[model samples]
Target: MVTIDQANQDFAQKVQSMDGGETLMLCFQCGTCTASCPSGRLTAYKTRKLIRKAQLGLEDEVLSSPDLWMCTTCYSCMERCPRGVEIVDIITLLRNLAVEKGVMSAPHKKVGEMLVKFGATVPLNSEYEDKREALGLARKPANTLGDEKALADVKKILKATGFEDLVGGN
Candidate 1:
């Protein structure tokens, strides 16, 4: 049986393997992150639980948790962490790991595809265009769906980051 120290050491090693997860080990379990998280209050989300899972080397629990995806990148937890742990960065790392491990669903994968294809999560359909025009804004040019140069840059970054494989394609 593993001792508490041994378990903690193992968790530390696992967190260290992640790009931005090294800071997660510094958390003191003060519950500040959970109290500060906006999503935790609304949903069953709990940032503190995620930190505990990471601290215990509960890899499957951390990777497959919807709480990790619920974070809005709002940085509230990061700001509240007294140990200066990069809470948002840790969440992002968990999200990337989840996606890479195929724990995320097809709809989640499609969101990435949509972002790659349209440069936005929400497709700017004709109704949106009509609403923009009705609000007195000039109609965007037909070719203004997505900026070509920006899309190319995004594709290059995604390819370099192995995000294409994470989402299962371009």
Candidate 2:
């Protein structure tokens, strides 16, 4: 039940002003994006409905929605859209906005924390290191995991992008 008073009115314009969100107002609600959404089949992610909510200025509802994070970004909806709407791009922008507002999901937050601490999403543990050694490979690959300077570089990049602040786990 979206009441008139709940509308921010400028939410749609803000979205439209975003780079990938230029096509925001072009949606005619044909439901094609929803029909073509793979995530919608397995989850409650209705791309069309979410776009409508954005158009209606339901900023809080749109940004805080778990469904907003459910997009696999496979571009299926964009491929099938009759209006050439950049649905996935808009979703990406929405996700960026959500993270900016500190509305990230727990699992995503954990991944961010891992990157901040380890410079990688999945740190190489002893078990995997042993397996790699047995296979005649280095315990850690030639990535941030294998190099302290590289890890420091990654942390620097994350900090520069404000990902550390958004993730919030030290």
Candidate 3:
């Protein structure tokens, strides 16, 4: 049911040109990646099918798929690939492309927002602080937790990458 106009003829080429995406065209649809995917066992995420879609230039379908975000990035598929395709990396690249287009799930947006505001995805909550203190560690790890300079640097990078705007963060 796919129409010709829906395909981006240069999609695969563009993927190949990106770092960590060089091995994309080497995929032969052996299904090894899909078979080895732990996420596929639980979710409807079929790595092989996604690769085929990319090969066939189904750009919109591939990028906008909710299944794209289901990968746990465990590298199980990459380890098992007979063709040595960087499946996880390709997924990451696709995710970046999707984000560039401002297509992202709510949870991912929330995480990005948290990163923008707090400079960390897991903010310094009381539960985490208590656990750290109990373990003889500083309540806030010496990272970007409450460090204004570090947080500002993170915001600068996010702003430079246009991620702050993508996630609706100031």
lDDT, candidates in the order shown:
0.77, 0.91, 0.90
Weakest 10 consecutive residues, lDDT, candidate 1? 1-10
Per-residue lDDT of candidate 1, residues 78-121 (tens digit)? 98789999888888877777766778756777888876676566
Give the per-residue lDDT digits (tens) of candidate 2, residues 36-126.
Answer: 8888999888999999999999999999999898888899899999999999999999999988787888888898899999999999999
Instruction: Tell me the TM-score of each prediction against the true structure.
Output: 0.75, 0.86, 0.90
**Mind sharing the TM-score for model 3?**
0.90
Which of candidates 1 and 3 is the stronger one according to TM-score? 3
User: Worst lDDT window (10 residues) for model 2?
Assistant: 161-170
- What C-alpha lDDT does candidate 2 achieve relative to the native structure? 0.91
Put down candidate 3 lDDT per residue, 13-92, tens digits, no spaces.
99999998999999998999888888999999899999889888999999999988988889999999999899999999
- In candidate 1, clashing pairs total 0
Clashing pairs in 3: none
